[model samples]
Target: MLPVDAMITNQEKLNSLATECAFHRFSIAEIQAATRNFHNDLVIGKGGFGKVYKGRINGTRDTTRRIVAIKRLDSFSMQGAAEFMTEIEMLTKVRHSNLVSLIGYYFDDNEMILVYEYITNGTIEHHLRKADAPLSWMHRLKISIGAAEGLNYLHTGVGNQQGVVHRDVKSSNILLDENWVAKIADFGLSKFIDQQTSGVSTRLKGTFGYLDPEYYMTGRLTRKSDVYSFGVVLFELLTGRRAVDTSFREEEWNLAKWAEKCVKERRLDQIIDSHIKAQISPKCLKEFVQIATRCLKSCRKKRPTMAGVVLALQQSMALQEQYDSSPQSASFTHIVQHLFSGSRLNSVVSTSASAPVTPIPHRFSSPPVTPSPHRFSMSPKLDKIDPVHLTLNLVARATQNFSPSLKLGEGGFGTVYKAELPEGQLFAVKRAKKEHFEALRSEFRSEVKLLAKIDHRNLMKLLGSIDNGNEHLIITEYVPNGTLRGHLDGAHGSVLDFCQRLEICIDIAHGLTYLHIYAEKKIIHGDIKSSNILLTERFRAKVSDFGFARLGDAETDGAQVVNKVRGTLGYLDPEYMRTHQLTPKIDVYSFGVLLIEILTGRRPIQSKRSPDEKVTLRWAFGKYIEGDIMDLVDPQMKESLDIEIIEKIFELAFQCAAPTRADRPDMKVVGEQLWAIRMDYIRNGRRG
Candidate 1:
């Protein structure tokens, strides 16, 4: 029996799962009738979780009855309420063709039961071990692809929620339907990954032979742990052998270790299942073995993601199909060479299953080649715009060989150059430094991937990019008016009035709102200083430089641990620096400092000022609390400021710069309050 505290925790989790899952609830009598009073003759499957009985029940929203699998928990079962509620929660939220569907559940009178859509065929382990029929190579390939897709969906996640790790992935969890389509079942030991956490530490929970060695030894579980277990299942499908057999010698008992040894010694032919050996193509076998071995790598990080596994399996199937359609005398090498000669295989090989998958950026002509017009199209979000790629030579010519005279300013990772193309169109080209090439290249790739997906008026538009041998460039639409910092420091010839400053702040707020909530994925701008903000000829603000941007936290706690801190010093959130816990509120804190900078026309920090006024936010906040908010306004602004509106703005700034993220307002609320303040300022005819 679970401890009192453990049972209470399980009950809380069950209550939360119940809210998201809206399946039918059966009474004890109905469940008993469906399972024929728990008769042994009706039992179709048995596990640590107890017996799964084949039963018939009326369909959901239909009069006709349908076959269902009713899982009844035994009184002395190893699994308890935790596993029961986890399955209900996961199945209700995720719906995929390759995953089994949950029909309903019953938890009355201490008799816990889960009803699932009945699969015509039994588990993969049953076919491999018990059935007289042998699985053909093609059938095995199809099953592998289907099962891989299901696991990929679980790891990649459903919508915005964190992904799930199937801690118990094995042959028994994969089922087949009438058409032989595979369906992954049994979420009894699954765990949801925190969005920002690389792995979770938990008590060991999985079958012995299929468990990841790293996870078993260290108890640190990750999606890669599931990848390792699925690799064992792949070997099982390939060799027609159980994962563990104590009858075999000590070393030979473990299939993963033995198969890895066979692969290392170049003796793969000795381990191929006799039933499918003759039907397997050499090319297909090679690809399958490559992916399977990668999945079983000792280091968890070296294991391929489930999506990568699915791709490799699909490629193997395609190779087998191609071989079947061709003559026996056709050279496998020739076919592979032909496929690799095309762009599809070239691109696919670049994003290998063993490496992290990233969107392939469009490469363009450098020197010594005639440049052609390449359509730089992005997906889903940027589908509405048609962008043209720029050649490196053309960019070089426009910027006068990256002349210092054409230099705009320097950014976090590179130098910004102003350019005017032959057609008279203006642009800003960022050229990365040669020193620290690896880090800069990573930042370059990160910025490109992030900029490609986002398309907003207040967000800087990514025009094109160049990645020649030693040169890396990012080209964006040039804002002729320079940066917000330049204008605030009078480098733009005149200081911005209060009304214009309010509009600029509002624009920044709108852009942040879109990034945090409206985008396909929530993004946090790690560095949100005033210098990173740009202005058009009309002084409209656009947030730029996504080098420090990251996907926001998906954990319920609203904060994620970080290994390294990145941001401007003065505008940095003190809490983030102190604790190394990142949240969207860090950006709000920076924005608060920017707000003070806008009102006062000062940098975040000024060592030249007196000790009491050195740091702008600290000094302004102190004055604000003392009811001297009017003194914080920019003395250069000639217009008379409204005292009521000034007090409200200062109050909001303090709220945004709260000591802790929990006390700060989300961007949605902050934007709304800013809009209200602007309206009030205008209502009193206080527009500068």
Candidate 2:
């Protein structure tokens, strides 16, 4: 029996956990009501630790009832209180569609219970073993991909939290929903891993058949162990047999070992489940078998990480989909003929291919008689090929012969001019400078290509372009309120409120998040600074300047070697500058500088300031450490500031600008954090 003090400490920890997680805490009365006084009829499933009861619980905010699975602890269960608490802690911190969600919990009157979003269907184990019909090839692929994604999310940190290793991974724990969507459940044996830590030291704890061979030999548990177990599950899916079946021959008892041997012998077809044997595409099966076998390698180092497993699984799925979508020779010939039709080519070419824009009739019959301060020497080849081809004469006339008064701003690419057509339609035209025309032509085309694929409210919109042999110009929607730098400098003749600044920061975060993760192709917005962010009349931010952007994958090592670093000096990532490695984190680091600038109303660098305050990040960080960061807040906005919001923003800024890429959170997390801060500010400010 534990001492009184030990019992009190455990209770205190539980109280803290209840407060930290956002899950609803249920009263014992509510639990009994939901489960009908623990009726035997409601018991849907039973396990070593508890019986899962399908229960109806009315939501706190609404009258609508929610069906949930309530797992109640048994008196003689194998799992004790510690395992229960661990499961609660793990589920609350990480959230992803592929992972089971914890709805609420009850731990009153010596009764420990967990409530989960009820999966309509049952466990993958059930379908694999006792179901009336075998899972189809497509269904199996979808389930495996979803399960792999959930494991990947656990192995790699989600949002602001560090990664959690789901120590117990098997087909039994992978639950399927009504739509056949896979959700990884059973986090009782999970462990959280910090960024610097490779693995944790712990006593061996896993099912016999699904245990990692290396982990079994050595008690040290790592993410690779989870991968090994997931590999065993894959083989179970592959062979439609239990992980360890004594009825099978001795060599075939262990699924992982048997599968590995079959793969090595190139005789995997012998064990392929007859149901999916003919359905599986040769290429997909080959890739699937290779990745699964690699996961079962005895050496932990040789085992693929969960993330690698996910990528491989996704690739295999894609291959299978392509095979499914392939047409016969006769159908393929017809498809080619249909694709070459003139109307289809014209409509699809604008977005999918580079088709020269059909030139519109010029609003003005002739060019302006007077040459403005900004002059564009006309190119000889005016109608040269490119997407969104605007006639040179129409653009030149719209901008009043590139008038100095109409010019909005200038960057490495060229000067931007606000153009107004006769119909009063406004557009921002970016005309390449004469001296750098030849050098920047390709860059101009790349930017056009990148912008064509982009479609986000927070990102600048691409209207059209003009590319003659000598002159190159890109057009976009005109943002009337001007750049963020202008507002920060008070060029707008109004001081921005604290709330407005916070909104602007959130908008920028949204834009960056989309660029880094949600775009059709992942992009690194190589340059991010106050000047690059343009504001709409309502103070909404639209991130512009894709001249230096690069197309890259965000999921791999996330680093690419660059011949030369390109970005505004003060906002450039220090690590990128020092090592010449480019990644999405550079934009994150730049955004950190922008955040500090927004709060302090100071430029990233102030040469005239004293040595201590010359660099805003350095000085702001020092003040942050001293708990006097409020001293640096913009004086005009200080009156409406919430201390908590200020601290959180500054804290996030510093985290983004941390010395190494590993220390920085991804843009998606940063966006979520900013939104949370905004909500907190709105709530707390009202209270004040």
Candidate 3:
């Protein structure tokens, strides 16, 4: 009874509907052929949901090859069609450099198939667990930074839709590309938060140690929760220990707690990865440890923001730069000696007015060169002057009319004196000896030029320079509180409280960050040790002395090398000493030594020790990891200190002291971790 045309139209409609509804749309023959007839050798990895197989897709006509990871879902999976739809929808909408890309998927009546990009390097978990596979500290730092950046993008990155919360951010979920760049994988459990919503509430879900304690307590999740998980990852990186090691007793089982105890006892060396021990700079090791401690805080509110974490890493890199560019202390001593021996007070005084003053270039950048002596002679009016007469006049005026009371301190170059200006302002004036005239001129010129350019709250300020013909005097700010070394040695009461010590560390980091990055040109504070770090009445740290500082340039500086071994002996970089190649890592190493001293209340090196015991802080730290933390803590301060905070501080010290320069974190990261530790202490009322 129906017309022929109408019958044809009805059949077409039925065909389209069938295509949409049927689960086994792709023929079983086609899938089996693509996977080489389901061969056992094709299997790559397996999980609860399905088996992942590596397969080569052959093009329809040309037989072109394409490699892919094919995940064949179990036929009896409880996830079903609805879960599949959710995954397909979510993955299709997201894309990033650090995220794995889904290629295609297939759904048959009895099975489901998912094809993904074949990552060559595999999961981060594999690298952590491999006994034969060695992961360097630099590689670890790079991985951590890359992983953090990826998570940060997911949590707050800009795009067409709202940001995603990777509910399960763990080592296992992170994949490495062929180049070792980290890419976050497995968005199955990921949740999307609408721009309007502050956070999401859901049933507690995540791996054991990586789970945020706050989220576990209240089912509410925020970006901070991810930060807590990252803290666990950081711990794994530092100690090379598993998050939950059941081999130890219940009290010592948790990596976080164990690390905290080790840190408090100034025994972080005990927990560090032995393979990378010699390679990491002490400064970076300490900074990494401190960052990990902050990430693992019981309270999520106290965790640092991801932005803060990034900035901290940048600062760590800057510290390493300063360490690399510094000249040796011996060279500095030589320069000082030359300055004192060559120049006379009379000659300096005579030439003061006629001397050409070229503005010194900024710190961290190359200094401008002075005009040749012949250029001065070219001027007819100055050509006939006697150099000797001018030197004596300058020296006479510099000695405050040759008064003995003006003398301040004796050094290799000459004597430094306290000079009171007409305005009643105090200044320290260094008078170079007559024998080292050219060296004095060079030193004076270099110091004035460099000091004039730097203006930091923590650095000693250059008031001005006096060239009174006979003598060359460099004037600088006078700190009444004296040097950090003097204060640590002479202070009668508790030298520095926990908070005050932390503040000093923060101030120094900020100052260093300014020199390295914020400055017009990056500057490295070549010699960064406690002695060079001065303190004010409030106990604020100010980094002083640019005598050995050099602007970094591959061509001009000749490949980042120190002609002689410079810096204080106890705080020197071993790598620099051995190779003569200095980098910012050197400063990080020295800072690490300084941090160990502050936290443990011990010297960098000590002579009094048992025959079997290691006298150095580094050795003592190793012993602490062996479950002897109590022995490392300073006897005088242990009872009054917060065990949690002390342990965290000690952990930071260890990271900074890591032997490998690449292993050491930047100063910026160090400052943030230290700040986070203090914040945690303040919030928790300093746990005993």
Query: Which candidate leads the pack in TM-score?
Result: 3
Q: Which model, 1 or 2, shows the larger TM-score?
A: 2
Per-residue lDDT over 242-315 for candidate 2, one digit per residue giving the tens place of the 0 to 100 score? 88898988988888778878877889788799888999988678778877877787877656566556655655
Please give, for residues 1-688, the per-residue lDDT of candidate 3 as tens digits: 2344543553354345335533122345656776897787998776645677888765333467667777777644444443454455556666677778766666544556666778888777778776378677667777787887787667656354376777777777787878888888766667777533447898887778678888999999877788888877777877677778898788768877788888889998888878778767676666667666767777764565554454344334434333344332222122223333544322111111112233221111123222211101111231232222223233334446445566544433455566554445454656566566565565456656667677778776765554544446566665656555554554534466566667787787777766655655555566676656767767889887655555545453223865665555556665665567766666767777777666555656443554233235445554434324455665545346655466656656656765456556777777776776777677676633
Rank order by TM-score, top first? 3, 2, 1
List the candidate numbers ranked by lDDT, top first.
Answer: 1, 2, 3
**lDDT for position 622 in model 1:** 47
Error of 2 at 498 (Å): 43
Worst 10 residues of 2 by lDDT: 346-355
**What C-alpha lDDT, on a 0 to 100 scale, does residue 530 get in candidate 1?**
78
Cα lDDT, model 2, residue 598: 97
* Superior candidate under TM-score, 1 versus 3: 3
Check candidate 2 and list the clashing pairs.
Answer: none
Ten contiguous residues minimizing lDDT sum, candidate 3: 371-380
Cα shift from native, residue 556, model 3 (Å): 10
Global lDDT of each candidate: 0.77, 0.76, 0.61
lDDT winner, 2 or 3: 2
